[model samples]
Target: MARFRLLPDEQLARSPLRELWREFARQHSAMAGLALFLLFVVLAVLSPLLAPHDPYLQNDALLLIAPSWSEAGLVQYPFGTDDLGRDLLSRMLIGARYSFGIALITVLGALLTGLVLGSLAGMSKGLKSSALNHVLDLALTIPSLLLAIIIVAILGPGLINTIWAIMLALLPQFVHSVRNAIAEQLNLDYVIAYRLDGASNWQVLTRVILPNIWERLTVTASMALSTAILDIAALGFLGLGAQAPTAEWGAIIADSLDLIYVAPVGVALPGLLIFTCVLSVNLVGDGLRNAMKKRRDN
Candidate 1:
């Protein structure tokens, strides 16, 4: 006789991370996105070892040089030189760290700070909660990019300021999402049961609510990361971030705008890198949404 086996309850599983990994792996697109993201991380990590030339070093002879494959280009400069004659390939490899590293930090900062604010808002009552919600509504009315610009303008243009600007711009989204999700979950039967069983609000949140909403938070974080990365590049392009001689992708594009018509690839390649990274992240986020939906359906 064949024996029937039951899957372990997700929350009770000894290795919930392993279970999540299995769920995450169910989506091929997510796996692909992860692979692409990892490739960028690796390239950034190994840039010093792998890059043939100094990213910031200039050679007057290599001015406006084409990629190595082009007839006019030298074999040494595989991705050619920028307007300043610095190695584009090396710059690109180095720039990956800025986007990925800063965005990761921004997302984590926004998540933690927003989570604290959201939890407080979700638990609070009366006029103060209403006032806070209204503030969030007002904040959301402004475009995030515009909000970021305003913050950057006040803070003055620089690398650190850009990070703070992006983080501030992203906070409202996380705060709103967490607040709404927690509020909704609080009214659910399981949450009420926990309360009736003498669980404190904090315990219910930690033991019951957060575990269920973990997937939603992760998906949001993934989406937020892509936005942060794009914003970093955009601010860099606008001369309000990263500054001159920095190899940031957006700044790289800005540097080559004059030659866009004459050497289109120089401009196009950086844009493509941004596009690919953003798309990969969005796909992963979408996959997480799908996985969460599937889990709920089952």
Candidate 2:
């Protein structure tokens, strides 16, 4: 049997998205990361049906039960029960929903905010641009997690507040990155040609600048998603986000902390999910960056 593969087309190039997929698929790590990412997403979506027991349901007798592989462990609770007697697997499935929600909402919100503000900063001149840059510089000095904590402190903690905090914390990074990218693109010969050909600022931005810089935006979004996941988990771990019984991964681990020695698997499972989620996003981002490098300038 013969095998076929896509090669980057020079003159008659494929559609931009299709070409990107071909490039992305070339990386084995990226493909595996994508698979793992999708698996989590599916689990999150189907949590209600897939979960054997109600996530919040507590069985007084099942407290601190080890995993099913353990001799005293019960078959009904595959991952066993937490100290609170809640099913670990059910809680994790439910928690994944919040994680994915935070990722998507935070990424989109930050991206939109960054685009509008960064474009203004990029296009403006003199004092306006200087002031915007200076403010962003100050904001960036605070790490994303710290910035998120500050916002959450003021807003008060909950799932919604956590989402907003992560989005705001991520905003400065996207703004700076976008501003730099836009500034660089503006000085390029093609952009100048567009300006000379009577393209309005909006037209140039929508038609040329954005299309050319999508790779940068996508990579930034990937990074933001991973950061958002970590921030949500950290905030929960710190007792500042997603209150008890919500099944958020970090809070789940917090509830099971006392059981770390008697039931290490409970704490480790949520941590493992968080680790894998962040790892998958980083791998995908790295793949996109490498693929973008191979792409010819638009």
Candidate 3:
């Protein structure tokens, strides 16, 4: 049997991803955001083992309990209880998994669909590209949240439907961004050189243009992550996503609204989680954009 060999250290140091990581690491805000995001991921992954109580189990006697240390609070329910008496900490942990998982799935679906359509649009000659652009523009005119709501309404309310709805709503933005990037690259010296060297259109696109535009795509994806999280949460808030008995962050907040005055912490905790997650993602996206700009300048 033949033995496999790893790349030499010098070659590894020159890798684009390694270079990108070095750049990303230098941005303190970006590193902080990454840390916070990773913490959420860890919490989500370990929720089953870490959460003290079953998220669904309710105790009527403990309904609307306050956080521990409050006069009426119990030590066992540190973060308090929801209206139905579900443990707030446990529900929030499980909600982290649901919210992040759904957002990631939706973004990935949109990214794949967009890349395919956008590449085709960018490479096409005349009429096909024009038609695709027109359709994408029409889709872009509507706000993504509104479009998502319309889709969810049409599809009927449910978790899977909300995912599909958000994915479709986010698709146009990715298509527009990728198509423009590819179209711009098509006229560049590198692309012309590749063509002159007898490289096929697909080869130039896959091996050259795609690599050059990857940084932009990553920034776009990060921004889309925040948007997807917010949109999914909005859908859940409206009772159109991750239906009752499921521990989704938005659903938790929505369910606690009527008791906001009575148990403000119950409503605030989940909302705080949503805000922190979205803010961190946006910060990371901004940091990436700045880093890419500096890289191009150098």
Lowest lDDT 10-mer window, candidate 1? 10-19
Per-prediction backbone clash count: 0, 0, 0
lDDT computed for candidate 2: 0.88
lDDT per residue for candidate 1 within 1-298, as digits (tens), equals 9986666664434465655566779889999988888887787678788878899998887787898899998898888887778888888888887877788889999999999998888888899899999999899898778899999999999999999999999999888989999999999998999899999988998999888777778988998999998999999888998887878888888888989987776788889889988988888888778766665565
Q: Candidate 2 versus the native: TM-score?
A: 0.93
Q: Residue 218 error for model 3, in Å? A: 0.4
Q: Write the residue-wise lDDT of candidate 2 on 1-298 in tens digits.
A: 9987766475225577766777789899999999988888788788889988999988898888888998988899889898878898899999988876667778899999999999898878899899999999999999999999999999998988998899899999999988999999999999999999999999988898888887899999999889889988999999888898899998888877887898998789999999999998899899888777765544
Order of the predicted models by lDDT, top scorer first = 3, 2, 1
Better of 1 and 3 by lDDT: 3
Q: For model 2, which pairs clash?
A: none
Query: Each prediction's Cα lDDT score?
Result: 0.85, 0.88, 0.89
Whole-model lDDT for model 1 versus the true structure? 0.85
Candidate 3 error regions (>4 Å): 1-13
TM-score of 3: 0.93
Per-residue CA lDDT of model 3 for 1-298, tens digit only, reads 9987777755545676765676778899999998888888788788899999999998989888889989989999999998888899999999988888789889999998999989998989799899999999999999999999999999999999999999999999999999999999999997999899999989988999898888888889998999999998999999998899889988888888999999999789999999999988987898888777765675
